[model samples]
Target: MSDTSSRIAIVTGASGGIGKAVAERLAADGLSVLVHYSGNAATAAETVAAITAAGGKATAFGGDVADEDAMGRLFQHAIDTFGGVDVVVNSAGIMPLAPVVDTDLDTFDRIQRTNVRGTFVVSQLAARTVRPGGAIINFSTSIMKLQMPTYGAYAMSKGAVEGLTLILAREMRGKDITVNAVAPGPTATPLFFEGKPQEVIDHIAGLNPMQRLGTPQDIAEVTAFLAGPGRWVNGQVLYTNGGAA
Candidate 1:
């Protein structure tokens, strides 16, 4: 339809994985999307192309999610191009598996910068800029609930995102904005497959009642609901892993 009448979404880290799925799903739902990528413009282009080829509106923008200035521009670009933003999905994150004692200080710092500070930067901007009736969705992980080893450092960062999601929802009481986080369980993404043997994957998949790994579309369905009809799902984290929690 028309640009002025359509909802607009900015899906950070939309180059692939859950981020790409969210962008495509939102676009399919009639929202014009700005596909944001950190260092993967080509893949981000694929996301945009897929949306457009399906008769949905989309374009890619590259920027560091952790940089406040860059993220501010991203918000502005959405406003400038699509009239205003109705949804913001902070799905960009880095997961480096390590036990706390074995975690390198540098890697830990990098995780904090991209996962924690990055979510904060984009979130505050969404708070100020996303139009009323909009939604802010941040990505956390099931690791927080899994209590699994080698995810300690990553879990710590997501804990902060959870705190931010809940507090922001309350802070937006009169603003009519919903702030929620989607903590997905084990999913089949390229990142998830790295270095894992088939047996290990099968074991993890079997932990859930569904006895399968979640697909990116599984997470996207929950996100699409929150961004649209699920307005009451605010200030909460939806564990969307086929009962994998």
Candidate 2:
């Protein structure tokens, strides 16, 4: 383990949406954050600006999450900039909705490349590089349990994430590091709202006991918990949906 006083975190997909929320929350928790984004450099800079303006340390880094070499460089950047890494949140992913039969193979492959392969690449590097007592969090979705139509491809990717979360925790037995996945349901991020009708959105929201869409902050709270004091809660998939699944 590195110095406990200078903890650092790397949050992929930190440009906007849930990733941005998690980055800000973790920065508020006193860890210097490396904000990773694939594109949209300007949005990523905005995230960093928000963090820094609020007396937190943050830097924007650009890279393709599924590219092993790029992700490796991202890890190196974190170490070079922040001294060492204590937490890694693999929140970079894409969700393309379509029924299994209707989904194109190209679309299926793209989803897997970003979500499944991306998580695996990041998790592997995190396992090799993170200091003992650190945490690695991957994103999944509660919709997997809901078995909603037009989500087969996305759900399949997240299911693989759940599996990876459990196995990685076991693989890190003696390291004192925790590996887990956060499965959110119908969060009202740009990603969630894209291409969906208001009626569809309302219908989905009504399924949850809360009867409302979750905000990015809601999910960020859980990420912050797992990254910090929630050390005992390892090898688990925490469903952050409001009684929807």
Candidate 3:
């Protein structure tokens, strides 16, 4: 657990559950993962060949996180392939259940354009390209504190990502970035039993109270401890859910 942050991570839906376990735990704590993916480019090249066959330092990218020119060419292909972009991680989303009177305004605007405007266009490009001590995280759902019931349009798009991670941690305070928002609960992804049944996925994995169901490395170890403890845990949303709420 030592390779300390030199920084360079992108991670949006990195081709699997919880963005491939937060891009292999942020490249096993070293951080040089760009992974990202939209239409599974061969499972994002098998999550960059299993993070370069485990010697960590990944790459595989793609786009369409609600496309703003494919998120500015996915942050210009992670700043021309790993040279900038500190840590973004908005685990690309979609959870369609309906039930707000059978909601459908084009499925609530395509789940608020991919979970609230793809985490506000990747936190407005990590608030203008993160670098100075960067970190953004943002993916949310413990069914918004378990207010479950066909998951109100995926908890109203993760309640606008917990109010946009508290207004982007007060709009990146002094730019010493740290935006935070990890809400995971019922896990066991395949997009959380994507078409349910199998006794409704064994009753949603026994309604999680540690009765099981949550492990994309359990929300990638609380998003690798909020992108490596640049602590103060700004803005905060952290539900990680074994308690199930």
Q: Which candidate gets the maximum lDDT versus the true structure?
A: 2
**Candidate 1: clashing residue pairs, number:** 0
lDDT of each structure? 0.92, 0.93, 0.84
Best by TM-score: 2
Clashing residue pairs in candidate 3 are none
RMSD to truth, every model: 1.8, 1.6, 16.2
The clash numbers for all candidates, in the given order, read 0, 0, 0
TM-score for candidate 2: 0.97
Off by over 4 Å in 3: 11-64, 80-88, 91-98, 116-140, 144-147, 155-221, 226-239
- Alpha carbon lDDT at 32, candidate 3: 84
Would you estimate the TM-scores of all the predictions?
Answer: 0.97, 0.97, 0.34
* Residue pairs in candidate 2 whose N, alpha carbon or C atoms collide under 3 angstroms: none
Which residue segments of model 1 deviate by more than 4 Å? 1-5
